[model samples]
Target: MDKAGSEKSIIALEGWLQTPAGVYMRAWEQSCLDNLTADIFGYNAVQIGMPEIDALAASRMPYKLLADRKPRAAREQQRAVNLTLDYTELPFASQSIDLVVLPHVLEFSTDPHQVLREVERVLIPEGQVIICGFNPASLWGARHVLRRVGGTSFLPRTEELISMPRMKDWLKLLNMGATQSRFGCYAPACRTEKWLHRYAFMDNAGSRWWPYLGGVYVVQAIKRVKGMRLIGPAWSRKTAAAPSAVPATNKRREQQDG
Candidate 1:
């Protein structure tokens, strides 16, 4: 889709988050968070985009929220946290954040690369970044298709759902190395049975072998020091090559004699 269309789609999706379909999507997101490691525990972590989820996750860590606005429920929770500071221009100093959880913000951002760079700028060396987003090529996408065709409740114009490889490339571009990745939420479409939902792990074996096929993708990356120059360039050598030794001119002696 065109850039304008993509932006409209994202806005529509954000609005739809309050709908039944959106609630299910958010539930899936929370499920992803439930599976996250406690590595952020006791660390100065920053959660961008979703204040409600951040508020809950940060309860375990020295956490803060950075977003465009504050959720009313989050404000009511009074989670001992800061709120609504622009993520694009964060208030924290360089290398201030110990961890960052990007809960599908990049997919909706106008400049995802810039956001990643800002994330890199704030993250401490070797700091972690956990990203969660919808997989473009997965069962989730198939569900989206059903939602469209069957006229099932769904938000129109969800932004460009990026692929896992593209997301890895973005991390690499920002000097973050992928440490681990996982996929979850394997519940089949049209199967609303609670047992079926609980048995989603039946697909876990396939997920282990092909994680990219799952509905949602989660990736953890660590920032690394980049572009250090310990040694000078080879061209900086001072010595020049000496010309090949030439035969002594015997003609000079013959000329003197003449």
Candidate 2:
């Protein structure tokens, strides 16, 4: 999608996020992100898109950068951008970033694969990336399908919501192994907050009964570089040939002189 179109779509999605369904998903995502990132210590952290929620709010990283695809006015955004650049082409140096949070960015991205590649490129070895997205194998996903038949769809142009399995595959290809994953927004899609509150019990029930079938998911993955070794002190090993280094003839001569 063109830059303008991408911006427009995200704006629409942001608007949807203010509604009852969006609020339901947003609160769940916020809690997940908070718990996941709170204990992570890093020098640099960046959050991509989803200005509605601060993905790194709980992180104690010295520097936090909020980036979006386009330039947004400060007053207009709840989570304003610190940098405005293309998602597929991040300007940061290779292996420079410590933590990256991507919230609902992949589904709407024009080149989602390249975006992941860019994330892999900027992330330092062992650095972490948290990704949040809509789950296609859920009731929310089914609603999108049903609504499409009526010549209307409430979801942003994310026609193909990426599933957990597919997301795992993408991470594996990037060498970013998923360490932890959580699913949220268990309640069915509802148009009003009253209906949403009525189904609030579903959240706990779904978590225990059908955790993987939630409407949204958050995955935390670490960038793993091949051939990387752990940092530790070098311990010297005493060898069997150590005593042989002292010439036997010299020892014998010394004994005879004595």
Candidate 3:
């Protein structure tokens, strides 16, 4: 998708996020982000998209930046944008950012692989990235698949729904290791708030019984870069020489002289 097309997709997704099901999904996503980001200690952090939820709100990073392809995005997300750039090409220097948050950006991006590559490029070694997205293996996903057949779809039609396994593969290809993964929003797809609240108990059960089946998943990954081991230094380390051992008779004579 082009810039304008991507922006329109985001707008549609945002609109859907206001619905009852979307509200529930957002609450779950927000709670998960808060818990996950609260303890991530770092100097710099950036939330690439989904300014709607303030992905880094719980982060204590001194330098926090909100980036999006769109201009300003109305600051409606309550957070101001520090950088407006394409996900495929981040303005920051390579390995400069400590943390990058992507809230449902991959499924919406034109080239999710390039977006992830950019994220990996900007992340320092051992830097972390948090991703939020839909799972194609859940009830919500099934509903989307069913709706896709008809003219009306539950989620944004522009989305190219990706499974968690596919995402893991993408991150792995970028040399980013998954450190933590979570799934939530187990309730059946319900358009009304009342029905959604009715099935809230399934959240706990789903967590224990069918974790990977959750509608949404969050993956926390760290950029893994292997360091080369220096075998020897240019200047050799000094070594102390040991005195040679003498025969028993010579040892006695030396003791007497002492």
Candidate 4:
């Protein structure tokens, strides 16, 4: 989609995120992110998109920043290091960031693969990346389809939800190893708060039986670098090199004399 169109869609989704059902999804996502990031240690961590969620609130990293397509006045005033840049073209150097959190960014992008490629580029070897997205093969997804068929629009325009297997394939293409994943918010879509609360039982039941069919999912992956070798410090390498070279040189000289 075009820039203006994408912005409008994002705004609509953000608004929905404040509604009763959306609020329910946000709470589960927050709890998942909090637990996932708490133990993640890093020098530089970044959260891409979804500025309203504060995805890194539980992280203990000293440097945490948010990157989004647009800058907000409140974040600017707070000096929160919110960079206004496209997800496909991050300004950071390769292998610099230790952790990256992408909250509902992939499915919304025009090119989700490009977004993930950029994510892999900025992450250090073995760095962690957390991605949260709406699951397409679920009751919530069914609701989205039914609403569309009934000529009622409840979700964001052009909402392209991705399935778990497809997401795993994308991560694999980027040389990222999928470490863990979680699914939650099993309740069905309900317009009224009362009905939404009533369906809370689905959360426990679905988790025990149909866990993969949750409305939303969180995935954690680690960047993997091939053909990498572990080496000692420069000083140690130089020190060890000198003795080996000296012995070889002396042996060659002695053979020549003989």
Instruction: Kindly list the per-residue Cα lDDT of model 2 for residues 162-228, writing each as its tens digit.
Output: 9988999999999999999999888887889999999999999999999888999999999999998
Give the per-residue lDDT digits (tens) of candidate 3, residues 1-258: 776787888899878888998889889999999999999988999998876787888999999988887766455545667778888888999999999999999988989999999999999988999999998899988888887666346777565789888998999999999999999999998889999999999999999999899989999999999783558664454322223334666889989999
The per-prediction tally of clashing pairs is 1, 0, 0, 0
- Candidate 4 lands at a TM-score of 0.86
Give per-residue lDDT, candidate 3, residue 29.
92
Using TM-score as the measure, the top candidate is 2
| TM-score comparison, 2 vs 4, better candidate | 2
Summarize candidate 1's per-residue lDDT along 107-205 as a digit string, tens digits.
777667777888999998888888987776776667666665775633245645778889999899888999888776554442344655565565766
- Tens digit per residue, CA lDDT, model 4, 66-95: 888877666431334368889889899999
When superposed on Cα atoms, how far off is each prediction in RMSD? Answer: 9.3, 2.7, 4.7, 3.9
lDDT scores for all predictions?
0.66, 0.88, 0.87, 0.86
Model 4: residues >4 Å from true position, as ranges?
Answer: 75-81, 232-258
RMSD of 1: 9.3
Rank all candidate structures by their TM-score, best first, as comma-separated numbers: 2, 4, 3, 1
